[model samples]
Target: MDWDDLRIFLAVARTESLSGAGRRLAMDASTVGRRIARLEAAVGAALFLKTPQGYALTAEGARLVAPSEAAELAATAASEAVRAEAGITGQLRIGAPDGCANYLLPQVARDLCDAHPGLEVQIVALPRVVNLTRREADMAIAVSPPDTGRLMVQRLVDYQLHLAGHRDYLARHPPLRDLADLKGHRMISYIPDMIFDRELDYLSATGMEVAQISSNSVAVQMQAVRAGAGLGIVHDFAIPFAPGLQRILTDRIALRRSFWLIRHADDRASRRLSLLADALAQGIRAEVLRLEGLLGPCPVRGT
Candidate 1:
């Protein structure tokens, strides 16, 4: 039977409705019905029995289900294996959320390009997480370690946020005497929901509830602070990269963030993947140390 027919069969069998399967497959209802009919004719058995409630699989359909799923799994594996064998020659699609891409990716990309001259890198920099199971990206740099099953997870290093402002902004604010003094100032950050929990907690702890100008990009936030718009709690990488921005420390900035390197479970064994992962991990380590130096040294740990 055609693979398309089996694909429709699996979608319909798992979802138990022509419309549901069609939606998942991005096909129209009539098209799904026609394909299912074609599949049933080829198999010489009715796969579904339409009842008032919906469609239910027949005994014969149930028997076919396991093998169909196994076929799909085999196909998926074969595709990945083929791509892996192609080595670093094809595109290495990387998914990165905005913050990591802006403050964290340039060095890594440079290093990867130097190491793997044949490899092409396609960066899918997004403000939100990309779906790996759909092959949206071959690997990703994420703040939260992916819970996606069987993916390889590498904890790169921990990073910190420090309050930062431009020299002129700091001159006017005259150095924060204490955390409570922050109440009267403009504080910049991502939408509170978008910021990691540790940063949000640090903001809340100061009892300063200032409306943040909405920003998804760390680069944008750093620019806002440099323009004297407000004091920003920014990652060390973001601030140092901004040039002339100084840390505003009355006491330690309490927000600690972690970086994670994620790859497709199958990519773990691919030599191209291993090379890229090593390069990224190495770059991240160096950046962490650079950030520490910018912050004038702190008791921080590396990967």
Candidate 2:
């Protein structure tokens, strides 16, 4: 079967419709349908089932997914190998949690673009983990490393978090002398059930089970904390961006977690991905250090 047919097949399987695949491939729906039929004929089996809603992958289609994806990866690697000479220029979409995207990605993008004038970078910030297998992003930066899938994981950098509060909020409330005092302060964080990663449940170890103010987005949480909505477990790198925020019980509550660089295993051979990943890792490490350095000394250990 033609590799182009397999490419179309993967697009349809991902989007679940001829029209959807057409939009992705820049082909008409009828043309996409004909290609899918041609692929089915070459393979001697129907690959999709027509349902009221859309095309659903049949058992045969399901089985073909892995090998077809491998073919797609190979094709992509071949094309990228040639383009590598053009100096890392292409659309590289990176999916990341909103906090990093909001607070960290702009500078990374600036550095990459300034270095490689032709490259276009897209930062897709979402509330949940990025789905690289589905081609949602060429790569992703994640707080928690994934356990499943043909993916490569690398530790990007470790960052610190601490219980923090707006100085106005701290002044309005009773003094926060220690960890035990957190029980009375309004705390902001990810909603308990909506937290997408265990590492992000930053308030859990503090014996606080509920968040009085919460949001799925870290930017929102930080904004709420800055607006004096509540005290929160916040990234030290981020605290400098939100003025008037102070790290509370810093010595007692300092926390460390890491960001990971994740990508499809098949992409290891692609120079574009490799270059982009290297740049991202270095940029993030430098940015994190630069931002955290902007923070003033943390609040005294107690009182």
Candidate 3:
């Protein structure tokens, strides 16, 4: 069977009109009709019944439509498998929460590139989850398991968050001295909607009110902390203090969070992605544990 004609038939079956299918496929109605007719002739069955209103799929057409869709999926899988067998030798785009990429990717990427000379890696620091449906990225490192349907998610490691401030800020403010002092302190916050719950819970428990210095980017927030605008909350590993930054609450008393590696369900077999995913998982696990140990383990559970 002519695959082009079958594709046209599938489009028409989905749209139920030659004109509609043509618009979708960027072809003319006549071209769509001809292709559909050719496909029907090759199949030895009437694929559609043309009525004044529109095209209606014949029983045979309905049956072929689903299998055709499945065939397309199978074809995509086969192509990815072929690429995987060819080895990790192409650009791999990894989308991640800004902090994760900053804290973990540098070493991981260096090692991967050194090990696989042919593989190139691009790390994108995204504020929100990249849309897998749109292929915004080949894979990702995320804080939470992404929407489950049609995604491949791997829980890499769980980590914790700490409230940190500049030593100078504390010195001038006379050191929080007690949780009660945070009530009037300035705070640099990440994206509000995705703010880790422990951040909020800590404030409530401590009888403090946060003054928000809102930032959308994690790198910006870290810089803000160094500039001494306010105390900022960040993953323990990402904070780069310049001899002045100090952990306000020991990790033992801080909020804990988890991280995951993810990829589009369809791109599971992309060779570059597979290698990158494994590298990221190992890199994150090692780095996060090292940082957590340095900062002191969180007293919180399931950390």
How does each model score on TM-score? 0.68, 0.90, 0.66
Compared with the true structure, the alpha-carbon lDDT of candidate 2 equals 0.89
Candidate 2, 185-274: lDDT as tens digits: 888988888889999988886678888888898999999999998888899888878989888788788889999999999888787789
lDDT of 1 by residue, 1-303 (tens): 898799888888767788988876789989999999999999999999999877899998999877886687677557657776554555677887766777777767777777667677777788676666545677888888865576889999888777777878777764476665677678877777776434234455445675466576676777898898888777777766777777665254547788888887766546656777887788887977786676575323210
What does candidate 2 score in Cα RMSD to the true structure? 2.3
CA error at residue 263 for candidate 1, angstroms: 2.4
Question: Can you give the lDDT of residue 252 in candidate 2?
Answer: 82
Sliding window of 10 residues with minimal summed lDDT for model 3? 197-206
**How would you encode candidate 3's per-residue C-alpha lDDT over 146-180 as one tens digit per residue?**
65568888989887667777767776674465555
Clash count, predicted structure 3: 1
Name the weakest run of 10 consecutive residues (lDDT summed) in model 2: 294-303
> What CA RMSD would you report for each candidate?
6.6, 2.3, 8.1
> Which stretches of model 1 miss by more than 4 angstroms?
1-87, 193-202, 298-303
In candidate 3, position 112 carries an lDDT of 80
Candidate 2 off by > 4 Å: 17-34, 41-44, 50-54
lDDT of each: 0.73, 0.89, 0.70
- Clashing pairs for model 1 are none
Winning candidate number (lDDT): 2
